[model samples]
Target: MRPKIYLFGDSITEESFGDGGWGSSLAHHFARTVDVVLRGYSGYNTRWAVKVAERVFGAAEGGGGGVNNEEPLVVTVFFGANDACLPNRCSAFQHVPLDEYKRNLRSIVSFLKKRWPTTRILLITPPPIDEDGRLRHPYIENPSNEPERTNEAAGAYAKACVKLAGECGIPVIDLWTKMQQFPDWKNACLRDGLHLTRSGNEIVFEEVVKKLAEEGFSPETLPVDLPLITEIDPRDPLKSFQQ
Candidate 1:
């Protein structure tokens, strides 16, 4: 069976399959070598993610459709944008206390470790927000057009995420910090303050590939799904196929 790479998180993740998305880039990079499974739940925070962790990743028993027989080679956890929403903001429903957020993140990592014991886990910090851009979003409901999230708030969660990754002995992609270093990052990296743009996704994909190389999963080490065409017999095509 083909190995798998699992991506778990919230809206940022759910949209990772979109045009010029990071998930799509990874899928293309590993095409035929591994299956990329996206388990993104838009608008979900770590608190909600923890509740359904087992259901999504638990090992199967008795031939159920669960992944009992196969474990993902890599799993990435990316969340926190919604959780960083200000308690009194328009997006209060998604607010999660800093302490609770840390606990939930730990729980998520623990669950993945238990279910896929040999899988390498990567934790990604939520990207920084652009308050002015967010306020300009047509869908925002605040009368004062106040942004629901702030880069400072998201940075705090990002810090917590990095700390948790260290405690768990996993690698983390500090997107919040790294993206801001780019020139004109506010407009180049994020589209609506919270979600990533094409350039941002490219950065994410690049970082992920770098991490995979560091973890020894470089393309040179992975197996291709099919044999080379040169290996097929020209004299007997049917026989070569059967072989």
Candidate 2:
């Protein structure tokens, strides 16, 4: 069976397989070596993710949980954008208390580790939001004309994610911090002050690849899923085919 890489999280992840998305870039990179499985639920926070974690990663009665009785090669936990929603400013439906957010993230990592001990987990902090961009888009209702989420609030969650990953001994991509390093990040990386633009996706894809390489999941190290053309014998094609 082919190896698998799982991407799990909220809308950012949900849209990760779309055109010019990070997930798609990874899929292309790992072609013939593994499959990239996307389990993104739009608007979901860690709280919601924990509820469905088992269904997605748990072992089946007669079958192995992940690919080929081995845990998925990698599982990315990306969230916090929605959870960082300013409670008083945004709808309560999406706002998760900071403490609760941390708890939920820990629970998610622990649960996955318990079920798939060999799987590598990478946590991704939410990217920064542009208040001006948000105001222009107005995706959320705000009578006070305030953005539902702010860079400052999301930065807190990002810090929490980094801390959690350190405690758990896992890798983390602190997008919130990294994205802003670029000039004009608001327009360069984000589309609507929330979702990622092509540049944002590029950064995410690069970071993920770097982490995978560090963890020995690089295509150079992994066995290709199919036989190479060079492996087939030119003099005895039938025998090579059978072999």
Per-candidate TM-score against the hidden true structure: 0.94, 0.93
Among residues 3 or more apart in sequence or in different chains, the pairs in candidate 2 whose N, CA or C atoms overlap within 3 Å are none
RMSD in order of candidates = 1.9, 2.1
Model 1 Cα shift for residue 110 (angstroms):
0.6
Regions of candidate 1 where Cα sits further than 4 Å from its true position:
58-69, 138-140, 238-243
Whole-model Cα lDDT of every candidate shown, in order: 0.89, 0.89
Cα lDDT tens digits for candidate 2, 1-243:
888999999999999999999999999999989899998999888888888776666554424343334568889999899999888885558999999999999999998787679999999999998988888887666788878889999999999999999999999999999999999999999999889999999999999999899999988898987578888778876776565
Clash count, one per candidate: 0, 0
TM-score of 2: 0.93
